[model samples]
Target chain A: MSQLHLTDEILMAFADGELEEPTAAAVAKAMAEDPTVAKRIMDFQQSRRLTRSAFSMALMPDVPPELQAAVLAQVASYEADGDSKAGSDIKPPQDAWIRRKRPFMQMALAASLAAIALALGYFVGWQAEPGTGGLIAQLESPLVHHELNSSASGKDVELPFGRMRVISTYRLANGSLCREFQLRSSTEAAEAVACRNSHWNATFALASPISDAGYTPSGGGDPMAAYLQSIGAGQPLVDEAEAKALAEAGR
Target chain B: MPAGIGQELVALLPRLRRFALVLCRSQPLADDLVQGACERALANAGSWTPGTKFDAWMFRILRNYWIDHLRRMRTEGMMEDISMQTQLVGDAGEGPILSRLVLSEVQRAIDSLPQEQREVLVLVCAEDLSYREAAEILDVPIGTVMSRLARARRRLMEMTAAA
Candidate 1:
C-alpha cells in the first residue's frame, strides 16, 4: 500500500482543512518544497475567495412585502397545522434567499406592488402562496391531477416542467393558493398558484433559479419571465379564480 | 433527537447559503434547499439522536437533498440562461477590493469543472468542511473524498490559468 501524497484526496483534505496535524504537516511540507503544488493550492484559495465574494453579493434579495407577508401567514399556518416534529420541516423565506439580478428586479416588482398597494389603501403583505393557495386550489389546477397522480405530497409535487419539491405553501386573495417549489433540476425555483375551486388552475405564477441555493434568480432564465411574458403576450394570466384574485390583489 | 434543532437550522442559514451558492449559484434555490432540509430534519428529528452535532446532521440531510435535486435537474433540464458567473463578470463594478476579481473568467473556469470536483471544492474550500465531515455529508469514503478534492483543485488551477 503506497502512502498518500498530493493525491486529489489529500489536496481536497488540505483545501477543506481536514488533514490531521501530522497529515496536514506532511502536505504542508510537500507544498513548501514544491512550488507547483503551492501554486495549485493558491489557485484553489482564489476560487474560494472569488466565488464567495460573488455569491455574498446576493444574500438578501428584493422579495415583495406582500409575498413576504403571504409566506409569513402560510408559515404560521404550517406551524399550527402540524407537529410531526416541530421546526423539522421549515423552509427559508423569499427575503432570505441569496440574490443577484433577481433581487434587484424582485425589489423593483415589490416597489411597484407597494406603490399600487399604497395607492389602493390595501396593506398587501409581501410573499406568495405557500401550499397551492389551499388544497382546494391545487386540486383544481390543470397540473393538480397531474401533480397528485405523480405524487403531490408535502415533500415533492409533480408539475409540468418537472417534479417540484414543496418548499412551503400559502393562500392568496383571489381564492388562489400558491407555494414555492424547486424544480428537480438546476437552481431554479418558483411559486405555483392555484385556487381551490374544484377545477384548480395551477400555474407557474412565477419562477426563478438561484445560482445554487444562496443567490437570487436572474431575469432571463426565470420562469417568472415566461409567466409574465405570457401575460403581456396576450396569454390570459389566470384561468379562473386566480385571475380574479390577482385582479383584487392588484397583481 | 435533540431540542431546538429548528433554532439551529435558523442559525445555519448563512453558512448553508454559502455552500449552496457554490453548488448551485442561486440564492432562492439555496434557501429552498435549506428549507427542504430543515423541514426534513424537523420531521425526522427523532432519527437525529442526542449528542450529534445538529449542524452536521442538518448538513447531511441538506447534502442528500441537494444530490437528489441535482439528479432531477439533470433529467428534466432547466430554464437556460447565462450562467450566474457570466452575469457577475459583466458587472465590472467598482466595488470592494475582492468583488472586482469575482468576475466571470474564474467563475467560468470553476463552472466548467465536473460535478464531482465542483462539489468537493465547494464543500471544502467554499464551505470549509473538513474531509471527514465532507465525507459524511457526501456519503463517500474518505479516500474517495480526498481524491475528488485533489482532482477538483488541480482542475480549478488549470481552468483559472490562461486558456
Candidate 2:
C-alpha cells in the first residue's frame, strides 16, 4: 500500500494500542517492510508519549489539601449519617464552606506575599548598599537565587518582599533559560523576567500596584508578556528544563 | 454514600484530576471541577449500576460540569480572567527538566487543539480510555472518537514540529 493510503485513524489506533491483533500484526509487517511506515509509527508513538507525560504531573502532586479534606469530609459525613442513608440531607455544606474559605484563602495569599516582599526588600537593601546597580543587583540576592532555582512554574515561592509565582519560563534566543514571575503583596504586584547566565540576571523588572488585574501572565496587556514577546522567546521552558538550566548555571 | 462507592470515588480522584486538568488547562479550575464532580457523583450515586465502570461515570460527570461551567462563564463574561489561564506545568516532585520541557511543549500543542478534539485526545491518549469507553463518556459514536483522536494527534504533531 502507498504511504498515503495508511489513514491517520489507523496509525492513531496503532499508537493508542487500540488496533485488533490481526490488523496490528499486519501493520507490524508493513512497518518492517517500509521505512517510511516505520518512521510514521515511531512519530505516532512519540506523540503518545508526549501527551501522556504532559499531564503526568497531575498524578504526582499530593492531592491539594482542600481536595483531600473535601473527600475525607464527604466520607466522614456519609459515615456519620449511617452508611446506608443517601440524599440532599447528607450533602456537605460545600457552597457555604467555599464562600467562607475563598476570601480567607485570598487574604492569606495576599498577606503572605506582602510579608515576603517586605523581608526581601529589607535584605536586598541591606546587601546592595549604594551604587551596586540598585534593583538589578538586589534581584540577584541569595534569596532570589534560591527561590528561582528551587521553585517550579505555577508555584509560589516565598521571598522576603512577597510571594513570587514563577508564572512562565522560556529559553532566550542565546539559549539562556529565562523565568517570568509575578511578585505580589497586599498592595503591589511586580512582574519580572530573569535569565540564567553565570548567575540569574534580572533582564527586566516592572512593579505596579494591584491595578492591572486585567493583565494575565500570557496575555499581551501585561508588560512582561510584551517584553518576552519582544525578545522573541519562542516558548517557556517546562519545569524540568528550567530546573536543569538553573543547575547548569550553578544556581 | 455506600462505603464501597466512597472508596472507589477516592481512588479515582487522581485520574479524574488528570482529566480535568487537560480539559480546563488550569489547576485551580481543574480541582474545582473534580470537587464538583465528586459531589455530584456521590449525591447521585444511586444512578450508577453495580458492576459498571465507575471511572467512566465520574468522567462523564466531570465533562458535563466543565461544559456547564464554560457556558456560565461565557454568559457571565468572566472568561477573560488572565489568572484563569495559568496552568501548573510540572510534577510537584523531581523529574528531568528536558523531559518536562518537552512535556510542556506537547501540552501547549494540545492546548491549542479545538475543544472537541482535545477532549477526545485526553480521553484516549492521556486517560488511556478505550475508544468505546471514551465514546460513552463523550456520548458520541466510536467512529467519532477515533476521528477526533486522529485529528488531534495530527494537529499536535504539526504544531510541535513547527515549534
Candidate 3:
C-alpha cells in the first residue's frame, strides 16, 4: 500500500465497511502508520454514533392516534376489497388475520367517525335518538341530492334531525352506487351506508354516538363493513371518478 | 407485492416518519409525506421487486413525494422555510435529561445541513443503510453518496463540536 493521504470518502467508506477487502486493508495499514488517518476514521465513526444516539427511537413521539387509525383504516379497506373480490375459494393463509383485523377495523372506523365529529366542530355530548325512521324519510331528499352532487369531502347540511355529511362513495360489485355518511345531532351521532336503487336505501346503520368511548359495534365487528362485504363493495371512488359518477347520475 | 407488505409498511412507519421529520423539519408535513408514500406504495405495490429491500423502496417513494411537494410549493410561491425549528424531543416520561439536551443540540446541527446532505446523513447514519442502499434511494451514484456522507458528517461534527 502506498503512503498517499486517504480521501475523506475513502476514509468514510473504510470506516463504514463499504470498501472492498484490498482497499480496506490498505486503509487499515495506513491507519496503523498515520495518527491523522486514524483520527479521521474515528471522526466518521463518532459522527455516525452521535447521530444514531441523538435520533434514538426512544426520542420519537408515539405515532399519533389519528395517523395510526388512518393507516389501519386504509389496510382494512384494502382487505375488504380483496375479500369481496376473492370470494370463498381463495383462502388467505392467515385465518387469524380475519379474526384479528375485524375488531381493529371497526374500532379504527369508529375512531375516525369520532374524529370527523371533532373536525366538524360538533361537541361530543349530544347523542342522536335511535329508531327515528321518520327522520330518515325526511332526510332522503337532501341525502340523495348530496350523494349525487357532493364530493367525498362533503359539505355540511343542516337537517331537522342534525347536521349530516356524506363520508365516502363506493360502487358495489352488482353495479350500484353506495355512500357512507354520518349524521350528528346536538348530543349524539350516527353513521350509515346507503345504496342507490330506484331510490337511495340505508342498507346499514349504527346509531351509536359519534364518540370513541362507550361505543362498540354489534357482533364484535362493524355491521356496515359486513354489509359492504356481503354486497361486494369496491374501493371508494377517487375524486375525479367521483365527479364523473355524479355527472352521469345527474344526466 | 409480498403477502405481508402491508404489515411491513405498518412496521416501518416510525422510521419513515423519523426520516421525513428530519428532512422536512415539520411534524404535519412529515405525517402527510408518510401517508402519501404509503398510499402510493399500496396502490402500486406490484411495481416493487419482490426480493428487494422494502424499506429502501418506501424511502424512495417518500423522497419523490417530498421533491414533488417542493416543486409544487415553489411554483405556487408557497415555498417553506427550511430553517424551521424541529419539534423533536425526548419523551418526558423516559431517558436521562442529558440525552434530551444532546438530542436538541444534535437536531439543530442536523437542521442546519443542506437538504441533500441531511438526507444522506439520516439514511446512512441514523437509519443504518449502506452507501449503496442510500444511493439507490436517492437515485444518486455511489460516489455521490460517499462524498455527501463525508461532507455531512464533517459539517455535523464541526457544528456539534462548536456547540
> In lDDT terms, which candidate is top?
3
Across residues B3-119, which tens digit of lDDT does each residue of candidate 1 receive? 555556555666665565455555456656766666666667666655545565666777778877877777788733325433322232223432433444445666677667777
Per-residue lDDT for B1-163 in model 2, tens only? 3448888888888788878876776777888899988877777776665555667778888888888898899899877563356354643432343234433556678877877898888776666667777877787888898888878877776775565
Give the Cα error of residue B91 in candidate 3, in Å.
12
Tens digit per residue, CA lDDT, model 2, A123-176: 111111113233333466778777777788898777666677888778877887
* Model 1: residue A29 alpha-carbon error in angstroms: 4.2
Which of candidates 1 and 3 reaches a greater TM-score?
3
List candidate 1 stretches off by more than 4 Å.
A1-5, A11-16, A21-37, A40-251, B14-32, B49-51, B67-104
Candidate 2: which stretches are off by over 4 Å?
A: A1-5, A57-59, A82-251, B74-84, B90-103
For TM-score, candidate 2 versus 3, the one ahead is 3
lDDT of each: 0.48, 0.63, 0.65
Supply fnat for every model shown. Answer: 0.18, 0.28, 0.31
TM-scores of the first chain across all predictions? Answer: 0.31, 0.41, 0.42
Docking class of 2: incorrect
Clashing pairs in 3: A126-A186, A126-A187, A126-A188, A127-A187, A127-A188, A128-A188
DockQ of 2: 0.15
